[model samples]
Target: MKWIRARLADGNDEKGSACAPGAFHALLEDDRVLPVRGDPYNGHERTGEILRLDDVRLDVPVVPPTFYCVGLNYTKHIATEGLKIPDKPDVGYRANNALIAHGEDVIMPADATKVHYEGELVVVIGKRARSLSPDEARGCVLGYTMGNDVSERNWQKSDRTFWRAKNTDTFKPMGPWIDTDVDIENMETVVKVNGRESTRFHTNDMLFGIDTFISTMSRYLTLYPGDILWMGTDGHSPDLADGDVVEVSLTGLGTLRNRFVRER
Candidate 1:
């Protein structure tokens, strides 16, 4: 089961969020009474017009967005990059642009010397939460999805913090789709740079697991229903070239694909 919010991008249309309530629990949770005007997820609910997927574009899945991201979430990434290991998890900061939906072109600044793509598993929030225990964190998760925390390396590592590095316009590419049934907390993900595997890591090596990370972050800020935790990449962020097809993949949510082409 999955939960998503979608809208038609071809023309001016109102977007909406819905539960993909199916025999699956995530789908079961959707309000079947409210059907989407179009989209595949609507057919199961019989609430809205079943729009052809090819006919409309997908927006970032969640609405009423609250974004929370992490740094150094993966352990192998730290080891491989020869980065200083933090005594505790490095929850450096969260950004404003990490809440994007699917089918959006991630921005690549014209003046940037180097920009890298981070393939990660994203945890989406299902309820309003604050200071949750590790055990309670997963319960509040709406599901797991894929994302690319596109970063500008110089700005991220050299600048004060990652604010300018990771938060560029459309830097967050999420959701070919979302699924709640999968064990995304334990999945292995890989980032392909122009069809070559750059970084791949299993979640077992993460210094702080999803539960602990989410719980820790909520303490610093209020997390709302549509909040998301962008799991930082697994180190091997290869530089992207114009017209580069950057693909990120997780075990259950499949591949979130986006191409990097310089704006004219």
Candidate 2:
């Protein structure tokens, strides 16, 4: 099932009846969505009223309780940067404030340069998991979505912790929607800059795949439903500039496109 968070496009009033109070609704054919009523951390439903997708403005599909990311997990990304592969996963956290929905503009910091896009597959957790084995890890996944791990390269190198480099407002563009039935192991990722293909890689090419990362993370802390993990990106990306449009596409998951505009 495909899921989305949307509100009627009449205005910015998010209290519209198209979706539940705080949960994502399942998308249906005929441009409609099944309203989900209940806590998303557990399970939800399509029991409520149906609304047209075109009539509502799609928001970020999910706002994860804990946004985690694994860097340098893709072999090509490491090799391209001439970085040594780590024996263990290099996991990190991303601020929720960085997230933006599809059709949103990524406001590039006026003082920044060397902003790059890292097209990646995002895993959304469905069930609570702790100390799970590789076999059990995959079961915890709720669905998959597309994301751009936008980064300011200069700040990444100079800052002690990746604050401004990775956590700028509107930096992370994830959506279109989430697909619950995607084949995570064999998906293809394609990235476009200004409508031109810039990077392409198979989802399974990561040096450390989902099973490993999920299993590893579970050993440290409990992962609840609605938690999300960004599975990193492959290959290199050209620096983004004002007016540049970036789109990240996963084979089964839809494309997430955002335009970059310099902050005034």
Candidate 3:
């Protein structure tokens, strides 16, 4: 099932009142959206009211309890940057304030130059888990989504941490929706800048796979429902300019499109 968080385009609260007030959870069917009573982490109960898919504006699919990231997981991307591959899986963190939905503008700071996009696959956790084996790790995942890990090369290199370089507001563009059924092992990731292909790679071509990261991380901290993990991207991106539109598409998962705008 494909689940989306959206507000009706009509600007009225008629149908939205049937669900969870603000941005409601809807089941995406053909060209229609059926509002659900609850969220994906809980159980999705049908509200019986269906709206045209075109008659709504999307919001970030899930506001996770924690935003986790796996850096330097791709061998090709590691080689591209002249960096060594790590012997073990390591998890990093990202801020929720940086997250924006599809079709939103990525505000490029005025002083930021050499901005680039890292298109990645985002995993949505369904159940709370801890210290699981690779086999058990898969059971905890709800589904997958797409994320554009926008970065500033200059600040990334200068700052000891990625506080501003990567976590600036609107820097992370994620989701049109989340797919509960996707063939993770057979997916491909393609990135385009202004409608032209910039990077493409086998989505599962990571130095360490999803099971490795989940199983490894669960050893120390608890993985709760609504927590998201961004699987790192492969290859590199060209320097993005203001007004450039970036589209990150994964097999089965819908494309996430965002435009970059330089703050004046």
Q: Which parts of model 1 have CA positions greater than 4 angstroms off? A: 9-48, 80-82, 90-92, 97-100, 218-221
lDDT of all the models against the reference? 0.66, 0.85, 0.92
TM-score of model number 2: 0.93
When 1 and 3 are scored with TM-score, the better candidate is 3
Model 3 error, position 197 (Å): 0.7
Per-residue lDDT, model 1, residue 165, is: 80
How would you encode candidate 1's per-residue C-alpha lDDT over 1-264 as one tens digit per residue?
Answer: 655555443452534434232211112123332234333222333453444444345566654365666777666677766787677655654565554665566657787768888787777777778888888888787777787878887887688867768877777778866687897547788777678887777855566778888778777877777677876767677678887888788887767888886756
lDDT (10s digit) by residue, model 3, range 1-264 = 898899876565675355555698898987789998878887878988878888788999998999999999998888887889999998999999999999999999999988999999999999999999999999999999999989998998899999998999999999989999999889999999999999999999998999999999999989999999999999999999989999999999979999999998
Model 1: how far residue 24 lies from native, Å: 21
lDDT of 2 at 102: 94
| lDDT at residue 188 of model 3 (Cα atoms) | 96
* Model 1, TM vs. native: 0.79
Better of 2 and 3 by lDDT: 3
lDDT of 1 at 240: 85
Note the residue pairs that clash in candidate 3: none
Give me the overall lDDT of model 2. Answer: 0.85
For candidate 2, lDDT tens digit of each residue in 215-245? Answer: 9999989998889999988999998889999
Better candidate by TM-score, 2 or 3: 3
